[model samples]
Target chain A: MKGLVRTAVLLGVSTLVALDTYSAEPNARDIMEKNFFVSKVKSLKTDSTMVLINDKGQQRERKNTTLLKLQANGIDSKLLVKFSTPADIKGTGFLQVEHSDGEDDLWIYLPALKKSRRLVANNKKDSFVGTDFSYGDISLPKVDQYQHKRQRNEQIDGQDCYVIESIPINETVKTNSGYSKKITWARTDNFLETKVEYYDVSGRLLKTQRITQHRQVEPQPARWVALHREMTNHQTGHQTVLNFDKIEPGVAAPDEVFTTRYVERE
Target chain B: MRLRAAISFAALMGVSGAGQADDSRVPESPAFEGVQAFLQTRRVSGALRADYFHAAKRPDQGSDLLGVTAQIKTLPELGERIDGKLEARITNPALNRDGASQSRLLEGFVTLHLAQADLRIGKQIVAWGRADGINPTDNLTPRDYTVLLPFEDDQRFGTTAIKLDTYLSPQHTLTVFISPFFKPAMISLPTAGRTLRETTPARTLANSELGLKLDKIGEGLDGSISYFHGFSLLPDLRLLGSNPVEPILESHYDRINVLGADFARNFGRFAVRGEAAYVDTRDTAGDDPGIKNPYLFWIIGIDRTFFEEMNVNVQFFQRRVRRYHAPEGIADLQARAVALLNALIDGQRDRISNGISFRVSNKWFNNTLEAEVFAVLNLTRRDRFIRPLLTYAFTDHWKGTVGAEVYGGAADTQFGSLKPRRGVFAELRYGF
Candidate 1:
């Protein structure tokens, strides 16, 4: 009985030591996942103000508010971006629907074009309006589209984070590839992405977008208030920055808004 | 020259200004100025390369190696509401290589585009219509320079044109533009630049000049179509001058009339498109040249992805040239589609004599790579020839090709002059 007790104690120690230890260094992947899964959000439905400044430091202001909603099912999405800020952009509206099949659709109505163009199977690498941020960076594809791998913890915009990488699977696409691979850094507390690096088809670092500003919500646990994103494309000397203001999430969006007919005719 | 450049510069500035217009892009907020500040920090990030070369045809060809061309373009910029690009190109490859009076190619010109309408001035290549020759067109013939007149095989005429484009609706797009330019020499024949007077029946010869053109284009389900009209000055040489009589000789000049239209449509794996055009050309009463030459061209193709890795694009193109004679000078300009086909296939791999060609890519390597193999066989009994071509894109930017052209016919046959039968070519290119 004494010998058996001693052997049992030795086995327990060995098993405990064999387990791999993980540290609490928040990386990019953590930031990406955290920003993606929000347990709660609020909507403004009222007029919202926004500002744009060019590389030359010239500034332009616009007022626009959107009827926004969110969903997390077979398809996840956000709906209704109505420009209410700048006088000219007062009525511009668009809907973004991201599907699990690895496609994100955008429907935008431009008064000048009279109707909206349905941008389907959009190029991931294409800059959003020539900004540092590519359309792909802002969109979240179906969860299974990427093979995720964890990397070491890293710092993004001075924030401690966890780092993760994702690689694509589909190959039929030849030209206009958005990114070959991506490195994402997420905040340690909430797992929201803070920074990401996009590689070109040639596996070269094409662009990088970093999240700098953050705001905290009073009620949510580990959830953030605001996220400021900035992107830079090395190939083309261009950049884009996004300032998502007072982002409150809470609204029921219509499913029909995601259809092609709505995108084309607005 | 100063006026021309100034006009071009002003038009370029206009287009560039157009790119800056967002139509409805308002900043997201008052403090969002950082976005633009970040983008402006990037400098022009691309390279430019230009080359010029000339080849002599024959001794009597009168300096066949005539012109030069230069072109430059900028790279795509990241993060701007509207990315702008600029291009300037100039060329003069019209050296009368055919030993005839008029050798035309790129009469040479200057053009600039700031991501908007294209503004061009000076001598340049302007193509009208869609037919191979019956109608007027350019850009189809290889850089080899030929007598594809009315179609201007590498031929360039001097002119200034502006092209405007606006997206009317998400499903529809509209473009409209007008242009004016100088005319060429009259002693040159139909393509040699005839004066309006030379085109008239009253004078022994009539020539016309001072031309104007206008067009309207619209995008459709599969593609787009454009309609156009042109009025120009031309020179008449009914007397047919010989040698050079600088300060003397009798020549008439008058206005010429020209009008045409083009259409194209492409859908998925299968596409059918063609062009039909007519030219009511005027010539001397005794001139037996084909007057109402009608050119017709069409292409039909089926594209499919055989498996996950292999892609195939099979197509067939048919072209016909019909000439009209007024039964006056008793001259015969005899040319047939079959004869041309035979001339194109005289001696080559793949087949002996036929107008039909088959193309296939990737039977090996599982298709991670691509290769297009084409063979043209001539079935006509009169003349025979064969052609085979293979091209491949090694990587995203590197591509190479090799092709052979061969033809054969009897001594008195229509394809008698093309004895050397085959031409071999190899080339490699990389994009930045």
Candidate 2:
């Protein structure tokens, strides 16, 4: 009986030691997975403004309303964006529905033509409505598509963060993203991403993204949302600043708003 | 007296409904609540435009003119399931008219939203088909070809009709349309020593136009199948009589049927769209030289983006006339005139006609500037057309556009006949 008790105590001690080791420093993949899904709320509605500034101090402003909803699977999502200001592009809207099979569907409506057209869904590296943010930059990257490694911890804006380096797993992912590598800075407490640096094929810095402001949207189990973001092209000296005038998380959004018919309406 | 009574009744109902508001809401007088509802549920928007066009060569064929236009649109919501739109336009130096003013209602309609369907009535514009500019299934509305607009779609006008769209499933819809008025396409026909007269079809129950369509809009594909039974928007030329010098031609509408299908699909980075329509005209046997013959028209296009920002679209179109007979060798002068007119209007100069269109567009300067070049080549008839346009946004509310249209080929070809109408144009618009 004494031997049996001694064995159980040893086993308990080893298990606690193992758990402590894991809690001390989580794996990079787990951290990245949390960072990618940090904003995947049940539903989100926001009125956003995007300002583009050139090297010569010229600026342009665009206003839009964005609606986002997570599908039942919790991985796929639907996004709708409608432009309201900037006369030349007023009444233009885009609808994107993500599928589990990686075949997303996109549709664009042009008020001048009074028609909605289906668009090919593979232009991930292209600009998002001519903004400095590429389509790939704004979308959440799949965790399994990259090789992640936990780098040395760092301090950003006087807050502790986990620095992670991610490299594309294959040539297709690399080509589609137009990025060879990405480095992310996520807060240690919430796993909310605060900064990212994109590298081109030749390992040159292409763009830098920074989240300047964020807010806790839910209280029971904390959920955070980025209120202000800025993307700057290091190669072109151009920058785009995005601000959310109003953001409502966990809001109720009807499924009808994601349809092409809704996008075609004035 | 009836209209005034109806207005008063509506106002009374509005005030009565205002009294039933939620108690938690801010308190206000009933009349004030009614006025607030009216103002809060309505949206108003408009644009002012200044345009100029210059014909450098063959000025007699075109014109040099300057014009200004004001477009105003309003949307008013009456209830949870009811809304209406009223769009008005006023222009100086009206289209095809010099030193004239014109005012018209571009679109005015009321829509009723039901559980599974939507019903719209009054004048409205409905665009059909999945193809780019060359749509074989877009025949429900007529166009003004003489409008001095840089974009081809700018010439479209609303048609008075009743339309119903019923949702059959989450991704499928069925549409039905009916119109009692027959509006014809306005084309400038050359009259060199010829007297022409036009007559519209009588507005009768039997003469009403009808259209039906079934559309699927999701699950990786967008497509539709449609059928239309209506009078042809383009009038047919009939030779009434001929004197020694002038030939008298009467233009009349012909009943016709159209069966169409269109689809759009994405394959990797390329989007493919295609449309086909079979038009069955009154000249089924191809025996009548004064009426257009039955024909099949199809178009297939593919678009892709290169270099992240430059988009290129390529399309191939073909038209095939059934039981076609050459109109070149008609012995009688009146018969020849009628045959030529029909052939010209239907683009049936060749039994099998084919063409290609290519467009390249790009944006720069943070999307403040856009440029596009569009070209069409008629391979069978050797006619060609090209348009180049550049648009720049000066500010949030202002924009400027400059473009030029040029046509080339022998006079007998479709686009070639309009060579003299080639010109350069510019426009500035401000929106509020």
Interface RMSD of each: 15.7, 8.1
Q: What is candidate 2's lDDT per residue for A222-245, written digit by digit as tens?
A: 667899999999998889999999
- Docking class for candidate 1: incorrect
Estimate TM-scores for all models.
Answer: 0.39, 0.88
**Residues B1-432, model 1: lDDT tens digits:** 334433443453344343244222423344534543332233211111111112122222222132223333332342332233333334333322322332233333344433323343434334443221222322211123232211112233334444343443433334444444334332222223222133322311121122233332212222334444433222222323334422112233323233334443334322232343232333324122212222233434444434222334444444443342322223322222222222222121111222444455443221113455544333343444444445443322233444554556664332333434334433232222
Off by over 4 Å in 2: A1-24, A218-222, B1-42, B56-62, B93-98, B243-245
Give the per-residue Cα lDDT of candidate 1 at B339. Answer: 24
Pairs clashing in candidate 2? none
Ten contiguous residues with the weakest lDDT in model 1 chain B = B44-53
Against the correct fold, how does model 1 do in TM-score?
0.39
Candidate 2 lDDT over B1-432, as tens digits, reads 334433443453343243223121235478955753454345666777776665422223345556668887777787999988888888763343354677778789999988778899988887888988888888888877766556677678788999999888758889999999878877877666788899888999898999999999877899999999998888888888987889988888899899999999998889899999999998999888778889999999999987667899999999999989888878997678677767777788889999999999999866768999999999998999999999876655566788998999988788888788787777767665
- Measured on C-alpha atoms, candidate 1 has an lDDT of 0.40
Candidate 2 chain B TM?
A: 0.87
RMSD per candidate (Å) reads: 15.6, 10.1
lDDT of each: 0.40, 0.81
